[model samples]
Target: MSLRMATDADVPAIAALMRASVRAIFPRFYDAEQTAGAEIHIAHLDRAMVDDGTYYVHEDGGEVVACGGWSRRARLYTGSGDRDDDARLLDPATEPARVRAMFVRGDHTRRGLGRAILEASERAAGAEGFTRLVLMATLPGVPLYTAFGFAEVRRVDVTLPDGIVLAGVEMERPVTAGRTRCPPGRP
Candidate 1:
């Protein structure tokens, strides 16, 4: 697989992959309604991430198999409602870089695609002097984030536009220099 920065032309395909990943994986952890809500609210592309050049796509045979990225902006995640300061720059020393939308094709999972994205994100954020990374993870993504050294801060419920509440976990991890893999027995 080839990993590279995402361009505007890749938005539509990345979005489709995200929705498909959610539909295939969320059912195991969420109810039908929640899954649908996540597909609508969580499975989306953040154009700001694209514009900022923070998003990435992993392709195999020239097809996008995985996608994700980190953000230095104040916005934590998509579907969280717009804020006046969403576009504000983060202070890397005091604010953790946001690990935004992450998804993998159902047929291409467990091949380390998610980990690869996280590693790329961590490296990029670390290079920018971010001391930590944070994300609001859908239920289906918690295990992957946890295995990547992220610790859960709390459980949260994000209400979609239609008032459907989608449960998620708020997770964070320190940006340890040169740390590629989680240490044995560490959560």
Candidate 2:
């Protein structure tokens, strides 16, 4: 029941956790294909790790039971709708960050790990010198973001590389000094 940074050895378990989180969180809001593709996001995580991005995992008895991560320099993509200037990455005037993705295994749900992950992400981002954090919220992730002080900036359609499309929301939170609000966005 302690959280630590993710190591390369944790990749496979992280992938399984991501898959489980997606399945558990999306049953009420997404089609099978859309929900299924959520797990594929895990494949991109190696780059995040290599970039020195912060990835936290909750381990119990040497096993990763829950996890989350965030990228100080996150990915931005052109998609199916308008973008808020605030949602834009690489803004010179703001120290921006993206909570690219985050998930906890299904069996570990309702035990405070998700909240722990979120707060850890906020701390990591804030400590890394970011003033604001952004994330694309999925149907099941909206409430969690809101609970972490992330306000909805806009809802848009994202076109994945494989031409898969999904409805998602852009949310932002101003990282105040000394506050750890939620898990990683990439979280």
Candidate 3:
């Protein structure tokens, strides 16, 4: 497997990977209603992440198995279906860089792909002079984030288009230029 920066050409495969990953993994943490709502709300590949050059994809045999990225933008996460004007530049001096969309193919879980992406994101964000990172993590993603040194700040209820609320966690972690690190395995 190899890791590389994402591009517009990778969007279609990225979207399919996102949908498959979410569908297979979310059901473990979410109810049927919540999973259906989240399927519509969370499974999208934001082109801005690629444009910002912060997104990455892990490919094996020319197929994308995992993808994720960080952002220096205003939006914590994308709104359902429609892409909005949420790409406002962030002030790294005052705001934590956003660790945006993160998803791995179901078969690729527990193989350290998520950790690799998270580390790459932290390093990129730190290189931009950001000392902190924050993300709205899906319930199934909490364990990974927590193990990576992120602290839960609060519980978030994401209201979906169909009036179903999906639960998420607001997590943050301080990341210095060379201080962000995590031990391997499901700790």
TM per prediction = 0.95, 0.79, 0.92
Model 3's TM-score against the true structure = 0.92
- Pitting candidate 2 against candidate 3, the one with the higher TM-score is 3
* Model 1 lDDT per residue over 1-187, tens place: 9999999999989999999998998899889998888888889898999999899999999899899999999989887577899899999989999999999999998999889889989999999999999999988888899889899999998888778888889999999897765857865
Candidate 3 lDDT by residue in tens digits, 1-187: 9999999999999999988988999999999888877777788777878988999999989999999989998888864434454778889889999998899999999988998899999999999998899999999899989888899999988877778888889999988566555545533
Q: Can you tell me which runs of candidate 2 are displaced by over 4 Å?
A: 41-46, 50-53, 76-93, 180-187
lDDT of each: 0.91, 0.68, 0.87
* Top candidate, metric lDDT: 1
Q: In candidate 2, what residue range of length 10 has the lowest lDDT sum?
A: 77-86
Give candidate 1 regions above 4 Å deviation.
181-187
* Best-matching candidate per TM-score: 1
